[model samples]
Target: MDSMQNAPSTEDTQRTSQPAPVLALLPETGVSYIRHAWQDMLSGMKLARLGATLGWLDIKLRYRGSILGPFWLTASTAVMVAAMGVLYAYLMNMDVHKYLPFLTFSLVLWGFASGTLQDGCTTFTSASGLIHSARMPYSLHVLRATVRNLLTVAHNIPVVVVVFLWFAVVPAWSWTMPAACALWVFDSFMATFLLGILGTRFRDVPPIVASTLQILFFVTPILWAPELMKTGQDWLLLDPFFPLMEILRTPFTGDIVNAAIWPAALGWSAVLTVVTFALFARMRARLAYWV
Candidate 1:
C-alpha cells in the first residue's frame, strides 16, 4: 500500500520535471522540409528496413528460374547496345567508335536516374496493400522503393560491365571508376528521395518525368560528343545531367580526373543532398494521404 502510494508521487514528480508543452511547428516552404526531413528519415529507418526486405523478396520471387537468373541483366544490355549501335550511329551521323562509349555510359546512368525517379513515384501507391495490412510507417515504403531501384541497378550493372569489356574500355590502375559509380549511386538515391514525396501525391508526375528524361536523353549529348563538333560549342554541356555524363564518360576517355570538375561534381552532390532532404521533410506529413 505504501509503495503504491509512493509510485503515484514519483510519477507526479517526473511529470512536473518535464519541459512545458511546445508550440506546433509551422510547416513552412522548401527550407522547412529540410529541417525536419532528416529527423523523419531517421525515425523512419526501422520502417524503411521492412520495405527494403519486401522489395528484395519481390526481386527474388520475380527472378526465380534458370541457371544465370540475373546474369541476363548484362546480356540484355549487350543486345540493346548492338541493336542501337548501328541504328543510332547511322541516324545521328556519329562515328560508331566514339559514339558507342557515349551511348553505353549514358544509357547506364539514365537507367540509374530514370529508374530512381519512376520507382519513387509509385513507391507508396504500389505498396498500398502492404501499407494497409501491416500498419507500418510510411517511410518504409520510400526505402523499399530506393532498395528496389538499387536491386534493379545491380542487375543492370552486368550490362555496363559487358559493354565496357566488349569495347575493351577497362579503366587504368590509377582511375577510380568505382568512386564514380558510388557518386552516381548517391545522386540516384537522392533523386528518388526528393521526387518520391512529390510523386506520391501527383499522379501525372511519373509520365511527365518519363517524357522529360526521353527529351533529356536526346539533348544531353549522349549520342555525340559535344567537343566533337566542327566549332567550339562545348558550352551546351551545361545541362544538369551534363555532370552525370562527364562522370560516366571520363573513364572511357582514359583521362585523369578533370581538376576543374572535382569541385563542381562534389558540390552538386552536396547541394542535392541538402535540398532534397529539405523537400522530403516538407512533404512528409502529406505523404500518407497522398499515397
Candidate 2:
C-alpha cells in the first residue's frame, strides 16, 4: 500500500518531460531483419567490413600449413600466368608485356567474382555444423569462402607487380587502381549477399555456377582480349567483364576509362545486388528448413 501510494514520484514526473524512443511504426523488426539479411544489393550499399575480414581469415586458414604458407599461392600464380601468357599471348600476336597484366588482373578479378558464387551454393549446407548448432550470422559463412578467394587474389598481387616490372610499362599509374579496387570490393560483397541466399536454396546451383564461370573465363577476356573479338566499340565497352576489369586495369595501366563504363558497370552491379537482396529478404525465413 505504501509503495503504491508513492508510485507517482517527483523524479518520475521530471523524467516524463524527456522524449520517448523513436520507433518507425511502419517498419517493424521482422521486416528489418529481412532487410538486414540482404541489404547491399541494388545500387549502392555500404561496404561490409565484417564480410571482408572474414574473407581474409578464410585465406589464411586455406594455406596455413605450407612451408611458404601463402607464398605458395604467389608461386603457383606466377607459373600459371607465365605459361598461359607465353602460349596465348604469342598466338594472339600481342607483346607479352602488353598482354600479361590483362591476363593477371583478369584471373585475379575472376577469383574475387567467382569465389563468392562458387562457395555460396554450399554456404548453408556446408555450414550445417554451424547452421544447426551455432547461432552465428549467415553472412559469416559467405565470408569464409569469399575471403579464401581474396587470399588467392592477394597471392596474385605480386605477380601483377612482376609483370609490370618486366613489361616496363606503367599501364595505369595513379588514382584509377584505388577506384577500381573500390569498385571491385563493392561488387564482390554485392555478389556475396545475393549468392549466399541463392546458394542455400538450390543444392545443384554450385556446380552450375562453377561450370558457367568456367565458360565465361574463356569468353570474358581472361585468356583472350576483348579487342580480339570482332564485336565493335559498344561490345568492348559493354562486355560483362570489361567494365569491371577496366575499372581495375585503367588504374593499374593509368588509362582513362570510357565515361560510359562508370554507370554501366556500377549500374549492373547495383541492379543485381538489389534483386538478390529482395529475393533473399522474401525467402530468408524459409532458409533454416531448406538448409
Candidate 3:
C-alpha cells in the first residue's frame, strides 16, 4: 500500500508527462490566418512576372498551332458585335452609327469583368495539383487567371477601336477612365481570391457562379441604355455591376458619369477588399485539403 501511494497515479503521470493536444493542419486564430493570407498575397504580387508568364503560356497552349491564336477571340467578338449591333440597333430604332460603338465598348468591358469573376470560381480547383505540390502563394493562381483574361480583353480591344472608327466615335482620354480601370482591377483581384477560395471548398460554386452571371447579363444594360430606363425602375442603377460598368463605359464614350457612381464604386471596392481578405485568411489554410 505504501509503495502504491509513493508511485504516481496513471492520471497524474498523464497530466505531468503528456503534452497538450495540439490542433494540427489548422491555424491558431482568425487573425493569424488572415495575416498569413496577406503575406501570400503580397508575395504573389512580388512574383508578378511569373504569374504573367504563366498567363501567356496558358493562352499560347489554348490556341496552339493556330495562326490566329488569340485573334480567334477577336474575330468571334467582332462577328457577334456586328450581328448584334445591326439587329439591336434596328429593333431599338437607335442610329447604327452611335449604337454599334456603344455596344462594342460596353461588351468589351463587361466581358473582362464578368470573365474574371467567373474564372475566379475555378482558380483554386483548376490548379489543384499545383496547390498540393507547390509552395508558392495561392494568390498567384488568381493573378495568373486575371492576366490570361486581360490578355483576351487586350486582343478584343482592337475590334472596339475598329468599330469606333467605323462609326466615327472618338473616345477622348478622360482621367475618370483610368480611375475606373484601377477600380476594375481591384474588384477583379478581390473577386478572384474570394470566389476562388469559396469555389475550392464547395464543388457547386462554379456552376452557380456561371448561372448567376448569365442572369446578370440580362439585368446589366449591355444591350440597352440605362437612360432609356423608366423612372420608377431607377433601382436598376443600384445593381453592383451598374456603377462599375458605368464608371468605365461613360468615360470611354466621352460622357460624364453621375456623381453617385463615384460613391457606389468606392463603397464596393472597400467592402469587397476587406471581406475578401478576411475570408481568404480564415480559410486559406484549409485550401490544400479541399482541393
Per-candidate TM-scores read 0.74, 0.77, 0.88
| Superior by lDDT: candidate 2 or candidate 3 | 3
Question: Can you write out model 3's per-residue Cα lDDT over 1-291, one digit (the tens) per residue?
Answer: 999889998999889897878877962776688678889999999999999999999999999999999888799899999899999999998988878888999888888878898889889888988888889899899999988888989999899889877777766687887888888887888898899988888888889988999998989888998877768445765688888888888877767788888888888788899999888878877888998
lDDT of 2 by residue, 37-129 (tens): 645232122334655676676666766786898787678888888888888888999977778877887776776677656766666676677
Q: Give the Å error, residue 135, model 1.
A: 5.9
RMSD of 3: 6.5
Off by over 4 Å in 1: 1-36, 44-52, 63-73, 90-98, 132-139, 173-176, 230-234
Q: Give the Å shift of residue 284 in candidate 2.
A: 1.6
Q: Which candidate leads the pack in lDDT?
A: 3
How far is 68's C-alpha from truth in model 1 (Å)? 7.6
lDDT of 3: 0.86
Candidate closest to the true structure, highest TM-score: 3
- The residue pairs in collision within model 1 are 33-282, 34-278
Model 3 TM-score is: 0.88
Question: For each candidate, C-alpha RMSD in Å?
Answer: 5.6, 6.6, 6.5
